[model samples]
Target chain A: MLTLYSFGPGANSLKPLLALYEKGLEFTPRFVDPTRFEHHEDWFKKINPRGQVPALDHDGHIITESTVICEYLEDAFPEAPRLRPVDPVNIAEMRVWTKWVDEYFCWCVSTIGWERMIGPMARALSDEEFEAKVARIPVPEQRTKWRTARAGFPKDVLAEEMRKIGVSVNRLEMRLAESPWLAGDEFTLADVCNFAIANGMQNGFSDIVNREATPHLVAWIEKINDRPACKTMFAHSKSEFADRGRKVTA
Target chain B: MLTLYSFGPGANSLKPLLALYEKGLEFTPRFVDPTRFEHHEDWFKKINPRGQVPALDHDGHIITESTVICEYLEDAFPEAPRLRPVDPVNIAEMRVWTKWVDEYFCWCVSTIGWERMIGPMARALSDEEFEAKVARIPVPEQRTKWRTARAGFPKDVLAEEMRKIGVSVNRLEMRLAESPWLAGDEFTLADVCNFAIANGMQNGFSDIVNREATPHLVAWIEKINDRPACKTMFAHSKSEFADRGRKVTA
Candidate 1:
């Protein structure tokens, strides 16, 4: 039995959620609400000291980090459809894409998520409530980001974030021109990981990666969006703030 | 049969260099000197579009990203000693360590490397030459960082980076208290990846993780340092800038 602890439709949570969906694996979603600071609660920290979501409890063998957790599901549960490629070279190629999400694209998307979506939600909270919530964030960097976003992201950082997003989108467009999938010819974990972040853009910043600017990325997003797993996963993902992001995109 | 393009031992390059040593695999080390901005040369861009180091070209197949490169070495050259555990669960555990290097620690260490070490090296360049060198850097974000570091990292950013480093170091101390190695009992790729960053701290910030503060971590670093593979890797790692880092630590 596998249980996945995750937060929302926008960030790292969606990465493993999509992986579980693509592989058609059965997992109980123990949704941790970030808006309530449930992840940083003492109870949750016992599960993961880092207090990050996308932690997996596989028969009490705990695993954290969405990247590791996604691959763990692929490795541990072989009966499910293989989301990672078998060839080592292809696997290496696939990993680069996941690295892109974890290291770069996630930050760009998250900057926008905080500024446009979550920031508004946080601003709506009373000063005492917001300061209390920010203080509870386990990671200092995140606390600074959330607090800053609530105040409003400076134009420079937001501008740089948008530029980075453009670079990510442009690179994706160029890559899709070659291989049908991010890893190669077949759908794999790379697609699942990339789709998690790309899906957010479709609703929240449609203009950044629409047909005109990034035709290949837009087409790729559309094709992946239509997948049964994508539909199923999105229908189930939860977040008070991200739900609004979904509505705005819708 | 293999070619590895890299620069600066302290950053991403040390990761694969250590892997190659641990596995006893010999690849052509096409050292791209960062001090002269050789990595940003047009020829180097053909090897890696991002103009980052630690790109491995196996025969004709090119793979970039230090995380992928390190694992690819294990997968392709199976005759060598295995740095990754065979058990899937252990493998998952190992990946968390590498993810820490890639997503968190790399930034912390690199922030210090820029502000404390390489920043001085970059500033030593003449004005026209420095401007020319900066112009060649393909990635805009990196160019900004390089320029910012040359001017000396703003106090606030460096303060935040140092705080992040403390967080990463504290987490390592806690994990080492539990297990002998980052990936449980075995010396795995996790060690190679982390050592790349941690090795730098021994000289640059010795007080932060010495025996008194984190006995386990200090002992762990010393043991890993004494490994024949690490010795051999450091002996051969080439970069004008990193050569200085090595001397400082030595």
Candidate 2:
């Protein structure tokens, strides 16, 4: 039995959801809403000591980290549809993109994301509610992020975030201009990992990621949007907030 | 033919070097000295657009990122000694530790490391010389990091870095207490990746990572130090500076 615990169709959660749909795998979706502090609950903590979402439980085995879980799905079920490149060289190319997303791109987008959406929700909470929620978070850095979001990200920090985002967009544009996907011809997990964040750009970061500024990225985003699996993942969104920064092209 | 372009026994460079030694693979080592700005030169940029070290050229295909390079080595050379777990679940467990080190542990350590090492090197440069070197760096965030290091990291930032390091040490201690290595019984790539950084702690952050405070971690370090491959990698160190933060057990 396979079970995936995730939040709404946000950045990290979108990864495995889309991959699972693409791979045509059957798994249970256990939604752990972060806005409601469900992820920090003791039950969820038992599942993942880190208390983070997008964790996959495969036959009594627990795998955390969205990218790692997706890779696990590919590794354990070789009979399933392939999302990774066959050649080790191509796979290395794919991993470089995914690693870049994990280390750099995701953080830049998530920082801006928390500031815009999560910041407001956190600020709306009562002082006691906010403190209680912050106290329950397992990671110290995450706790600091929550407290900072509630208080407001520093002006310089926010500027640096946007700057990083701009760089990511430009690099994506440059890469997509050369090939159909981030890792050459194939639509591998590199695309799946990056599209989660790139999908948010048309609506959230149109100032820097629009057609005029980043036509290749915009085109790539539309291509991924056309996939049937992408639609299925979007349909799984729980609320309008889940589709907060996503714009569907007709 | 495998050729690895890397620096000395520093954080990222330590990973591929140790993995190559452990796997018993022969490869050409193209040492790129960052201190001399060789990594940022035009010749090196052709190999890796990011102008970062620890890039592997497998035949004609080039792979960047230290962790990704190590994984590439595993995937391409199944005949070599295994550094990854055979079971998918164990692989996932191994990955969680490696990913955490890549995303969190390494940055905290590198931040402090840069302030102590790179800051003085950068500060010692002539104004024109520093500006010329900074202009050659491909990544914007890296440029900002170099500038900040030269200017000196903020006191608040350095304190936060130390706090993160303390958390990392405690987590390592807790995990080591349970198993012989990071990912249970077998010494996987997870050990190789973290050991690159953990090996530095004895001489560098001795205040927080000593045997008195973290006996399990200390024992694990000593165990890894006893490995023939570990000794081989350390022997390849270019300068006394390469052994700056490493303490050899008597």
Candidate 3:
């Protein structure tokens, strides 16, 4: 049996969550709500001292980091509906985008999400409560980020983040114009990873992401959304994030 | 035949270079010297559109991104002397650190390296030459970083980067004290990816990384340096970086 410690379904949490659904694997989903700062709690930290969500516990073994967890799933269970391609060449091509998601795309998308969506939710806590929450965070850099999110990011930083989103959109469009999927013709773990964030940002970046601006990416998102596994994954999402996913596909 | 487009023996480039050396695979090394801005040249862009080095060409196939390339090497060449552990549990553990290096550790180390080593080299180019080099860079974000490095990172940014380095150091010490090698008793690609940076930073961070503060990690670095591949790879490094590597192992 497998267990996934996640923040419902969306962002980094959704990669492994959707992968499990795609592979038709059963996992006990233990939700660690970041909005409530439950991840900063001691019990959750015991599972992952970093206090991040989307950690996987495979029997007695533990794996953290969504990208690592998704790859581990592929490695441990190489069944049909394989997330990565069979050929090494295509797999190499697929990883370029996955690494892009991990290194560049995720940071730009997360910065925008935090500034707009997560920050407001985190800021709603009282000063004392928020201060205590920040202190409890295991990593110093993460603590500063939470504090910054609560305080509001600088205008220049957010503007640069928007510009990066535009760059990300351009990169994705360039890829999708040539091939049906991020990696190539077939949907793989690359799609699973990219879709999670692309779907989340669709409504917010509608001006840049609409059918008119990024036709290929728009079509790709719609097609992936219609997949049965996508539907199953969305069925588990919390209301706020679920609404965003539904709106993007609707 | 294999072809490696690399920026010589630095952090990111060293990952796959050392991996190939460890496997005793022969590859023609084509240095895309970033100091001369060869990565910005059109021909190199054909090999990798984004023009980042450490891209591997296996026969006619292209693979970019250091972490992805290392993982691909393991997948395509799953023989004896595996770069990653064979056990699923250990591989999962190994990936955690690899992902950490990609996500958290690398950025901090790179920031320090840029401020201390690479930035000065880029700054040495004349104003007209630097502007020309900057204009040739395909990606906007990378262009901005190159410019920032030349101008020097903001004091607060550098300070925070150092703090994160401290966080990384503490985390590594905690892991190394428990396990003989990162990821377990068997050395894995996690070491290959990480050693490139840790060894690179030893001279600059001597106070923080010495035997007193981080004994296990220091010993681990020494043990990895003792490997024939590490010595061979370091022997190929340019003088400034070579001096740093030799000092740590000495």
How accurate locally, in lDDT, is each candidate? 0.84, 0.87, 0.82
Write candidate 3's Cα lDDT for A190-243 as tens digits: 998898789745577888998898988899889988999889887765534555
Candidate with best DockQ: 2
Fnat per predicted structure, each in turn: 0.84, 0.97, 0.86
List clashing residue pairs in candidate 2. none
lDDT of 1 at B192: 82
> Which tens-of-lDDT digit does each residue in A119-168 have in candidate 2?
88899999999999989989877898898998999999999999889888
Better of 1 and 2 by lDDT: 2
Query: Could you give the DockQ of candidate 2?
Result: 0.89
Q: On residues B1-250, what C-alpha lDDT tens digit does candidate 3 reach at each position?
A: 7888887777888899889889888788787766567888989989888878889999888888898899888888877368998777788888878878888899998887778656777778899988988888888778889889999999999998988899889988998999988888888898888887787455668879988899988998899889998788767654344444344335
**Best TM-score among the predictions, by candidate number:** 2
lDDT of 2 at B151: 97
**What lDDT tens digits, residue by residue, belong to model 1 across residues B1-250?**
8888888465788888788878888788888887777889999899887888888989888899998999898878878999989878899989988997888888977887777677888878888888998888888888888888889988998898898899989988898999999999999999888888887576678879888898888889999889987787778766777767766556
Per-candidate DockQ vs. reference: 0.78, 0.89, 0.74
lDDT of 3 at A24: 89
